[model samples]
Target: MWLGSEFCARHILRHCDTLAGLPAFWTREQHGEEASTWLLFTHKYDYLKHLADRYRSRAEPMTRTFSITETAITTSPPRERVLLLLAVALMESFGIQVNLCLDPAYRQLEGFVLDRQRCAIIANWVDIDAVWHVDVNTNKPDLQRYADALDHAQARSAIAAKTPTGRLTALAGLLDLDWQWLTHRCGELAAYGSAGIADPHSRLLSTAGVDRACGYVATVATHNG
Candidate 1:
C-alpha cells in the first residue's frame, strides 16, 4: 500500500533514469528468466556488450555510469562471499553500483566488509535503533561515504494528533537520536555529492506495476541490499 503510493508519486515527479534491480525489465524484454532469477542478475551479453563498448568509449574520460542492484541482505560474511563478493565482482566487471537495504540489526563486521567494497546501504527507521541506521553508502575510491537522510520523511503513529513541520518534534524526539550528528552527516553526504535512487516501473514499462512484489527484497539488499 505504502510502496504503491510512492511509485505513483515518483511517476508524477520524475521519469526513471535507470531501472535497476528489476529482472522483469530484462527478462520480459524476452530475456528469459532462468537460474539468473534466483541469483543476482544483470543484462545479458547483448546489453552487456553494449555496456562494455560504452565503458570503453568513456575510457578517456575515466568515468563510467552505473545502476544499482538493490538486494535483500543474506546478512554477514560467509554468506556474502558467494552472495555479495561474486555478485559485486560481476557487476563491477560491467560497471554497476551496488546498494544494500540493510537491517539495523547489522553488525560491526558488516561495517568492515562493506567498507571494503565501498558499497552503499539503505536502512529502515524501525529497527529499534536510532539514526545510526545509515540510509545509503556509496563507494568512492579510497573513501567510504554515507547518506544518512531518509527517503522517508514523516512517519505515521496510531491515534496521534499531528500538525505542520510534516512531523511533530515531540513525537520524533521520542526516537532519542542525536540530531546534531544526523544533520551533520547529511551535510557531509551533500558535500561529497552522495546520491540516492528512486525507482520507477520495472521493465521500463510505462509504469512499474505496484504489486506486493514491488517491495520484494529477501534478506534483498545487495541480494537483500
Candidate 2:
C-alpha cells in the first residue's frame, strides 16, 4: 500500500463520483497515467487552461474564508505534499482519510485509516480472509476495537429480522404486545421474512443466518481407510 498525499487526495475527491463501486485496490502507475492521459487527451489545453482559471478565481475566496497565509501556499514540504495529494485522492475517491498502516508481511506499503481518523500506529499481519481478527492497539484508538466490533455489529445487523423465542412466560405482558406497534417500532425487520414482528421468530439472525453472496467457497481434505 502506498501512503496517501493531499494533492492526490483532493484529485480523488474531485473524481470520486466517477470511481465508486470499484474494487478495493487499483494499479497506481496505470491509474495515474490513465487519469493524466484522460485529462490531457480530452481537449487537453482547454481543460488545463480552464483549471488554471478556476484555480485563480477560487484562490482568493479560499484564502479569505480559511485565513491561509501566502507562505502556506508557496512553501509546502515534500512529505506534506505527498500527504496532501494522497488525502485529496482518498477524499475524492473514497471520502475517507489514511489512518491504518498495513501489517508488514504483505510487503505492500499501503497505509490504512479505520473509519477515517488520523491515527496510524496499528498494523494487522493476518491474511485478508482472517482480516476480522485484526486488533487496534492502544496507540490506534480509532481502530483498536474494530475487529470484534465489526463482527458484533454485523451480527446485530443480521439478527434484526429474527426473533428470540426461548420462552416468554416471565413477561407475557411484554411478549403479547400488539403487532402494529411492534411493526411500527421496527421497520428494518421486514426485509428478511414475511411474518416479521408478528412471527414467533422475529429476533435478529446471526451472521450464519445471512446467506453468502458469492465466491465464498472453501474446502477441506479427508483421508479415508
Candidate 3:
C-alpha cells in the first residue's frame, strides 16, 4: 500500500507540464494501484536522452566557465571519489531508493544517482540523523560530504530563489532537467521490475528528487522554502 494513486501522479504531471511524458515522477506514496499501470506504459527514450544531454551541457559549463571548485570539501581521498563513497554509505544507512547514474557520458560532474525504488534522488549529502530515523554518525566521510553538499546546494539555491532572473532561469532549467530524469528513471525502474531485474535508475532520478522525497517521507523539511 503506497501513498497515492495513478490519478495523483497524473494530476501532478498535468499541473506541471514540464513533467509531461517524463517517467518515474511518482513517489512510493503514489504507487498503490497505479504502479503496475505505469510499469506497463512505454516512453520516448530519445526525448529523455536529449533532455539529459542538454541539462548536463548546461550545468557542466558552470563547472568549467567558473573554473571554480566553488566550495568543495576535500577529504583524505579525492573529493569526487569520497563523494561516491559517501553516496553509497548514505543509501545503505538510510534505505533511500532513488535511481543513480554514475558519470553518465563519462562526465565527471554527472555523478547523479537516483533512487527509483523509492521515487527520489540519492543525495551526495544527507542529514541522516535528521531524516533517517537513526543516530547521526559524526565521523563518516559520507555524512560529512553530504552535509557540505547540502549546505552548499541550499545556500546557492536560496540565493537563486531570491534573484528574480536567477529563479526564473533556474526553475525553467530544473523543470526540464528534472522531468527528463524522472521519466527516464520511471521507465527504467518499471522495466527492471517487470523483467525481475534489479539495477538502479540513476539517470532517471536525481539528487533533486531525493531531497524532495526525503522531505515528504520523513517530513524533515518543508517543500515551501
Candidate 4:
C-alpha cells in the first residue's frame, strides 16, 4: 500500500515497540556480528513485507487498481523526505545520533544510527518509489538486493517513467489506511457489516469502534520529545 511516511512510521511503531526492538540478523561482516545495521534493516523490511502480505490476504478479491492524481506528488514534498524526518525523530527520541543518506541512483533514503566511533548501530532503507509500485506485484525491496538492482538501466528507466498518479492493487488500497481511527477500526468493520444503522456517521462508528486517535498522537509526542 502507498502510505505516507508518517503513516508508515506509526504503523511500524504500533506493531513494534520501537526501532531498537526490531529483530536482529547476522550479516557478512568480518567480525560476524549479528547486530550489523544492514542486517537489522533487512529484518525490519521483512517484517513490513509480512504485514503487507497479511493485509493483502485479507482483502476482497478484485483486479482493479487505485490511483491518486498526479498533482498529489507534484504539490507535496517527496515522501522520502517525510520518512527521513520521521526516522530522525524516532532515533533522536531514543537519544541516538543518526545520519541520513540519500542514494539518488537507487532512489533510496537510509537512516543510520551512529556510535561513538561513528560506526552504524543499525540502518534502515526506504524505497521512495515503493509506494507507487505496491500493487505491481514486483519484488519488494530489501537491503541485500538493493545494490545489485541499482545497476540495471532498465529498472532505473522504468522508475523514471512512473506516472504521477501511482497505481495500487485493491489489497494495497485496503492496507493504505490513513486516519488512526480508520486503521484501528478497519479490522472490526471488515469482520462485521454496518448492521443497518440509521445515521451514516453513527453507522460507521457503530460498526467500527470508538475513535482511538491516541496512537498517532502518542507517536507524535515521542517524536517531539
Clashes of each: 29, 42, 24, 0
- How should the candidates be ordered by lDDT, best one leading? 3, 4, 1, 2
Candidate 1: worst 10 consecutive residues by lDDT?
A: 23-32
Q: Model 1, 71-172: lDDT tens per residue? A: 322222232322222222233334332222222322121221122233433322221234223233344741232212111111112112222111212212
What is the clash count of model 4? 0
Q: Model 4: which ten-residue window has the lowest total lDDT?
A: 26-35
Q: Which residue pairs come into collision in candidate 4?
A: none
How does each model score on TM-score?
0.23, 0.16, 0.19, 0.21
Best by TM-score: 1
Better of 2 and 3 by TM-score: 3
> lDDT of each structure?
0.25, 0.24, 0.26, 0.26
Clashes of 3: 24
Candidate RMSDs in order: 21.3, 24.5, 18.5, 17.9
After aligning candidate 3 to the native by TM-score, how far in Å is the CA of 89 from where it should be? 29
67, model 4: CA deviation in Å? 26
Q: Which window of ten consecutive residues has the lowest lDDT sum in model 2?
A: 212-221
Better of 1 and 3 by lDDT: 3
Residue-level lDDT of model 3, residues 47-156, one tens digit each, is 22233443443322111000012122122223232222222222222322222221112112211222212222221112122221211122345434433343344344
Report the CA-based lDDT of candidate 2 relative to the real structure. Answer: 0.24
